[model samples]
Target: MQMPLLIAADWLLVVCAEQLAYWLRRDGLPIAVPTFHIPDVYLYLIVPAIFLVFLHESRMKFRAFPLWKMTQAVFHAVLWSVLAIIMLMYFGHVAQVVSRLFVAMTGVFAFLFLIAGRTALAALLDRYHLFEVPVLLVGGGDEADALLSTLAAHGGCGMHCIGLVTDARVPQKAAARCAVLGHLADLERVIGETGIQNVLVTASGADSDEQVRLVRRIQPLVENVVLVPDLAGLPVANSEIEGILEGRHIFLRFRNNLARRKNLVFKRLFDIVLCLLGAPLVLPVCLAIALAIKHDDGGPVFFAHRRVGQGGKEFPCYKFRTMVTDGDRILADYLAAHPEARKDWENDFKLKDDPRVTKIGAFLRKTSLDELPQVWNVLKGDMSLVGPRPIIRAEIPKYGEHFADFCLVPPGITGMWQVNGRSDTTYEGRVRMDSWYVRNWSVWIDLACLVRTFAVVLRREGAY
Candidate 1:
């Protein structure tokens, strides 16, 4: 049940599965099974190496294994197996000798074996609580209560609360559930006695100076000293400390396409090519929109808004004008008069039946012809054919720190969010889709989004 033993057992299972796969591929079965020429030793190295790389990339340590993490490891193992088989066929110089069907069967067997082993390990770990870590909560009042609640929710994942340590006198209700050993001064003594390996302090109960002192004192005793920020709802960008004192300032950065540079470049190239090819088709639709807008209200045919683009740069994004002239002014007055519409506008940034939209504009928006002008932006390199949707300055505040990180790449005319659900999705859902795109971007992914966008546009799904 110890961490080292658990890790050793997992490693052994992986090794055994690899060996079995090798044996199956090398030898013919007793019951008249087909045999193929296979490089058994090569896969032995390939499978483990791929698993190790995935493990490192995921940042999962042996002590804190979770079922979800284990499932991901198995999934990556399968992916790597497929990749290795492809490489062998293409470049291993022995494709003529090996049966392609046999190679495929080996991959499937290996994948199933990996998944089964991990799943079994996960069940065993959960049943026994083999990797659970003893944690000592240190705080008081509502902050302490909130910490307790969070620990209770995620208690299965190696975080066991021993008790609480508070600066102020513990409330009777909290004391009933968790023993309050002592105040801040008793932290070190309590941790030592309880054999606690982790100390978690809430920012609300512990001030900056006290937090610093607690960290320094607990550093030598416990495995880690964790500070839970006061702001529970806000997303925290992953942060790191660099260099020694004087240079040791914290750097906060969002998790993005750090491992996807090559894919991003390929995607950008694909975007350029698609935009160029679609220009002729998109131009005529844009012209028609321009003519329609001109005929309807005799106003500017295009709406140019200063939008946050790549790296938070302000760029004029073009769209066919979908609203009446002075629509911005009209919006404020209309929202004031119709409180229900204002509430909906606050939630979705859209109004279903607004007087501001011209008749032609309604038709254009329904079919998404209004977005044709953004193809020019894509051609001009201000945007991509696929990426996060650009937002105006007014919308920046709503996105908070994530806004800046989202702007690292150019905005897109059609994106993962747009194809997935568009205006029907919640703000949080949109953020998740955008983040997913940033992390998993590829040329193929872009193409897939474009293909799906065609279907979405045709169905007019999620269009207001």
Candidate 2:
């Protein structure tokens, strides 16, 4: 197994991190560097050893390979590593023997070096197609095909599809890229021969009884088994196990920790701090935009429309007006004449070539300059800096089942929907994305979304 190799790499990375930290501290702050020295550097070996213990204890090292998950593991590992160093110093009666700055620098370096090493190793493995887990699928359908394609598309996923075990003699196109090893009855024999460690069951059109039997049989044989929950359509946004009965079943909920007061406190604090820092950078551009709007259209520079906000409360969502004063009238006449335009409006509530937009408005929309005013919305707490897009009262039913989840947090000026496909995404996709944002909200995710928004805007994708 590559498990031992990964562990070994981690240990070496930790050592390199500590050495680099010591060198940096010595060079960068020579005056601040401790003049005293410990009896032996060998005593510091406990840091890496502590990392291994915490990695196993926290089980952070054992999760499935996702970049985000790996990042979290690295952070947690480094955190525990620091704690272990403190404990070691305390217990060994050498608390003052080591420099505080050394410990802090080592912890930071460990995080950076470990992540860099893991990333480099994964890239090498992916490029050379080495150290990949061989696996086979046991299904045939769109969902089955999509899963196979997804794995094939992402090399870092670490699974290579050797073949598939289908219900038929020949596999479909989804599994056609591989091979039809055999039917469900041949699963055990095929796995035994091929040494397949992972089995992803996505057998569509097969009888439920056959699926149950296959699961029961395959569970004991395979090292890893993943059920796709095909019966339910992608398991609602932010859905997680609420509870479970002993040896029976589990319950799921669409909500998470949105009610945590501390989380909200941090979220609000972040918004306020960010808004203050960002205001100066955008102030000049914003003033120029207001002047342009006034010069071009002789109308209001800022637009404020009632939008459904947190808890179904109405708040004026502000924007630099990008449409003509008679925008509504223009849209009505256009939609009445063009079924295509109306259809698009009914679906995504947007027009690709909206006639109601002024020339400056089009430019502002494409460049996303029009959203500058919504920073005020974020400042006022009516919206977040990153969240679901603000909706109108009429669009409430469009959120449907996800309304409560959507309302759990304030809408954001820039969010998952904006950074993703924006108006190009299907209405259902947008709603589901909002639900996902609510479910998966985190400080890192919010920051990531904000960063991605810049790139998306530059690309001008899904801009109307």
Candidate 3:
């Protein structure tokens, strides 16, 4: 049902985009006063068919996919379809009649339409549980709880946990979320009774041989058996598995993306282009904020703090001043008076309520307008638009071994931590996120982070 519905939605959206593109090229933004040559029926049919074929090959289905993964898949499908259309036009000698602008417009419209359509479809399905795959969890440990939380966080993933089957001691919190159906020995009976189609196993404590045997034994009883690997806090984006000796020996390989010179250059170019294009908007807002800060208090508008950049280089990271001149003194006095506040500051380096922030500064911080000045750092090659968060020297020791990975890429104004939960995330969590971003950095991930940053800022989530 999910697959069929998705196919229908995708076809409809592609057709609509073609018509919209035709209108835009012929009527909305006409290139010349020449008569328009309407696209042939076969051309329209073939283009959509190509898209469907490519999307099918990409495994567009009811499953869990992060935003970047979905975007990458959809973008490739539309791109290939557009290229095929161009080749057909040239080979059929219709390139003169079929406007190149029309073809270009169609590809742009199709990409947007397909992404929007799929996102809406997922939301609708999640809201009604229309195509959720009910599965039984086979563990009751921390890994199992984390998987459950992930399912809850990504409602559109289409996975639903009915119950659990475990032999180990189940945590009280895990039991509260989902009941234990039966022990490992009665797993077959529980599945038969419940008629579950999928089983998700977390073989965290099991040896390799036992895990393999357990999976082989369960293969005959379930439609799908998903084995969760115990590789938390590792880079998965650029990792691949290799099989040798007739699939007897398998090895996982992880690539350090930043180690390649081309990737580093691409990232720099991405940052510069985005910063330049965004300057017109950013400059005006910065000016307004500067005036507001000056009106609130006669202090310097811009603040530059020392932060570690790429290659362990020290640079001045700029931001709009959001605190009083005597911020340190005020913090010391306040922490002395309020002993509980000291713990929060030590843990996260942030305070929900602080005495040093001015009225205008608080609003700037909440909206993240204070970080607008960092665009200069981006243009200067000291920072990126999306990478790890900049850390001060005092916080270097906290990252420990992960600090090497953190310095691989320049710091960013917004990154994984900012989008996840700016001030709400713990310092250790921030370090882990930074490490992950450094390892799994890609153009798609950066674009997705930029998109989510808007929603996070607008919602004022985890802001101080």
Candidate 4:
């Protein structure tokens, strides 16, 4: 039922995209752009059918994918669908007659409309567990509890743990969260009784041989069998599993995407292009911020805090001055006077309501306009547009072993920490997020972070 509804919703959005593209080409928008050739609307109605086929081929209905996976699948489907349409048009000798602008606009609108629609649909389905796949956990303890917590946090993943089937004594924490239906011996009976569609086998104190046998026995009972390996907190984003010796042995390959020379060049080019394109809009806001800061304090417009950059190099990170000249003294004095505030500062190095912040600075920090001057750092090659957050020398000990990973990429104006929670995130959690970003660095991830940054700033979330 869920699959059919999702497919219908997707088909409808594709049709709507075609109409919107036609409307854009036919009618002029407020922004000026070249438009030519009146597109034949009826001739393009077959686009939705073609797109739906490509989407189905992408396996969107196979499993409940996380939001990121769903986005990637939809993007690929739309891209391939557009290419197929172009090829078909060229072969049919209709490419010259149809408006090229209309064709391009349709692809753009299709992706936007599909993403918006799918996100709304996923949220709606999650509210009622309409599309969730019920699965039985074959292990119970810390492993099962951790998996349960992750599934609960990401409801869009479409997995729901129905019960546990471990032979060992269930830990109090796991027992409290999930029902232990039966032991490993009753795995078959449990599946029959509960009508479970999938089985998740976790490595919870089970020997390799026992685990393998359990998987083999359960494979015949469940429609899907998912193996949960102990590979958490590792960079598996750009990894692949290869089977050697006629599938007798298998090993996972992890690629260091950031280390590639071509990727580094591309990342730099990406930063420069974005900075150049955004200068016109950013310049005006920067001017306004500079004026407001001057009016509020009659001090310097910019502040450069010393921070550790790529390769553990120190540089002055530029920002609109959000604090007074005597901010260091004010912070020290305030922390000494207030133990609670001191504890908070020692924990995250941030204060929700610091007395040192000027009136204009508070708004600037909330809106993230204070960091506009960091564009200079970006252009100066001191920073990338998206990477790990710049850390101070005092915080180096917090990162510990992960500090090396953090130094691989230049610090960012905004990165996983800024987009995820910023000041609200724990110091340790920020370090973890930064380490993850460096390990899993990709052009797509950077672009996604940049897009999420705008939404985070606009909503004024997790900022001082």
Candidate 5:
């Protein structure tokens, strides 16, 4: 594993050194011409050696070559290489000797070179399974079978399942070629015999106490131990390590903290600027929508509903009324009459060809113009320009405990899940997307989502 990375690093160093020398000559720096004198020959030798040391010290085995981890390593390598080059130049009493442009160019060249070469290296690592880790599955239930199938499908995780260990009766029937090593109680003995380096506890059949015991017992024997949470129908946004305590216990927390005060400030400023600038243009459309609504049905043009917002606060969310006066009552009556509509309602909270929607309301809902009134929500600080969609107060309990994480950030007019597939996506998928957005929030991501929202709204792919 280190051989390819070392060779790649050496080649990258040589190329960068040569380029730096050439660029220095071009810049009229009084550096020796390219002949037999390589300005940084020592770099070619020492850089790769130091890289190997760091790689070994960090334990960056090829088995854990996820793109994210690889990127982090590359970044670390580039940073160290830059610092090393600077130190070498300073020690050689050549601080003012080398062109700054040459040093900067070398850093950029090394970064790109390593990134490209790492891709090839990763391919080679995957081909040989050189760093595959032996993983032991500790359950024999349906979740274990599903996890096995998933692992089989994703061959790149580099986890080679040795076998399964479970006392559950049903697991034996579904256990594919994976042999049942022993009962759950005999996990320690199995680990001792097989030398399993990783243990994955399926959260389904195993009780919490059993899972905790398995972790405690196996921690001494194995290098990695992970517990799969039994969160069926719950969204697993994205996992992240919070910290390590006392060099023993690891803590993991999940929440989207990207929509912080800085982001909130920027988003609000953007909204206020855009809203003020376009108010004249938007006013006419608002009036046109009001006229259309009034013409279709002589009822109020604006609709207000209690929606759960940041920190689980209920606020009156505004939207263009896209239904008749007694739309909710009518919906209940309709669902009672036609049981099939209940399925659609349950899935998407929407009804196709909803009878309660007035003639203009149907058009507004299709184009999503009914949500225009939420601009006021953005103005009032009750919502953001980009965030998770707000849900009704009545829908809060259904989200369970993870709902608090989702509500940490204010709801948005348009968000990742909304632009991706609003009503068309599964409820669980929406929650997951929302959770992911919260976990991985960034201004650029918010801007991208906003741009995509415009395109999606124009296309109206899943508006209704």
Candidate 6:
């Protein structure tokens, strides 16, 4: 509950960054001498107020930031720094003594230091469990178990589930992580004893009326109360908080994939720009690869296979020919000879020592040069630059319920699975990975995966 210290730290860190920036910029990066003097008053006074206001605008409450997330805090820091620069531009002109270079330098340092400070503080809090908010879990059965698991995994999210208030039918001994402090009737007593600030309602067995009653009773007792809806089993994308019946009953709507054209338009523009930029570098290499493939097997240079794309429509996902001619026949013969290879192929749809792969193909696959041609697929609107791996019709059932979610977006040549572990990942494991990626889709995540793909390829950790 001693969270005001974090707020104070936030302010002080920005001021420190500004001072550091002043010295660095005045003396260059080497810190020699002040060529341009920064207005001391702005660095010490006006800028701190500006930062607090921007942070307030970002809806930063005096709460533990474990739930707020470091990425969001860093993002807020950037936003405040930009706004601070704009404010200085206006106010500095009136003050008659502010250096533009100094202001720019201050902004840059403020951004970095704010992030670094918050990260260090968050880590300290996590280490000491300072941000841990004692909470009571309401309900029982599978939902309760899932919530318990989630809370345990995300302890740094400020949720320390101190006690449980489950139904009598659900054995209290079953929940080994936290003690069953009391039953539903003794909820207030449990809260008082546990010093609970948050209450999580996961009423799996309870009906709507019981849920409403529980929520009404627990509303004033805790600072925050969360309801876990029945939709947890399904992969939902965007969710929203809403109130019904004149604000008495509130619940979260776990939204299904709402494919917005604007987002797709953004993705398309990103794909096109990246492709055009890399075309020159990749084209020559692609030509050489084609020639080698042709020379190796006297077969087609490119291999285009019909793979499932967005909306369950099939598209020709292109790649350089990596397998020998009559690949299927060769694979059957190979599998017949080696039981271990057959088992490996059955498990992950990949073979570490595939007899069908040409030497050139093996090298290309290892380095992920095989996917260079799929940039064409990205440009032609068939696949994304980063998404779920392109699945053929035979692989649809492998996704199960995940199939619908997977098809909601275009398949990718490189994705969460490809980056995390390509051929080494099991088919079921990939389904889970791709499902999570789709459910938590963001432009930042896509960019991160694309960047990590290079590292993964270079390391050749999972690639065959």
List, residue by residue over 1-464, the lDDT tens digit for candidate 3: 78888888888899899888777766787364246665566446777888899877867553577777787898888888889888887887654576788888888999888877887788778777778889889866888877777777677379778999988878777787788998988988998999988988988788899778778878898899999988998888878989998998888999888889999999899888888898888888888998988888899999999999998999999999999999999999999999999998887677899999989889988999999999999999899999898988877889999999987889999999999988888888899999999889888899889988988899999988
TM-score ranking from best candidate downward: 3, 4, 2, 6, 5, 1
Candidate 2, residue 95: CA error in Å?
A: 11
lDDT of each: 0.69, 0.78, 0.85, 0.83, 0.71, 0.75
lDDT accuracy of residue 346 in candidate 1? 80
Which stretches in model 2 have alpha-carbon errors above 4 Å? 1-71, 85-131, 141-143, 149-156, 168-178, 203-212, 219-222, 231-255, 259-266, 273-301, 324-339, 355-369, 439-461
Candidate 4 lDDT tens digits, 321-423: 9888999999999989999999888777789989899888899899999888999999999999998989898889888999999889899999999988888
Best candidate according to TM-score: 3
Worst 10 residues of 6 by lDDT: 61-70
**Using lDDT as the measure, which candidate wins?**
3
The local distance difference test score of model 1 is 0.69
Model 6 regions lying over 4 Å from their true place: 1-37, 40-49, 56-77, 94-130, 168-174, 233-237, 249-258, 274-306, 311-330, 337-344, 351-373, 400-405, 413-429, 432-464
Tens-digit lDDT track for model 6 on 310-424? 9999999999989887999999999999998888776667788888888999999889898889989988999888888888788787789999878878888788898766877
What's the TM-score of each model vs. the native?
0.46, 0.72, 0.93, 0.91, 0.51, 0.70
Clashes by residue pair, model 2: none
Cα miss at 217, model 1 (Å)?
42
Clashing pairs in 5: 256-438, 256-439
- lDDT of model 3, residue 207: 84
* Candidate 2 global TM-score: 0.72
Error of 1 at 395 (Å): 1.7
lDDT of 1 by residue, 192-250 (tens): 88988887876575667877776778789988888776854332322333455675454
Decoy 3 TM-score against native: 0.93
Candidate 3 achieves a global lDDT of 0.85
The regions of model 5 sitting more than 4 angstroms off are: 1-40, 48-57, 61-66, 94-96, 127-130, 142-150, 169-174, 185-197, 203-208, 216-256, 262-431, 442-464
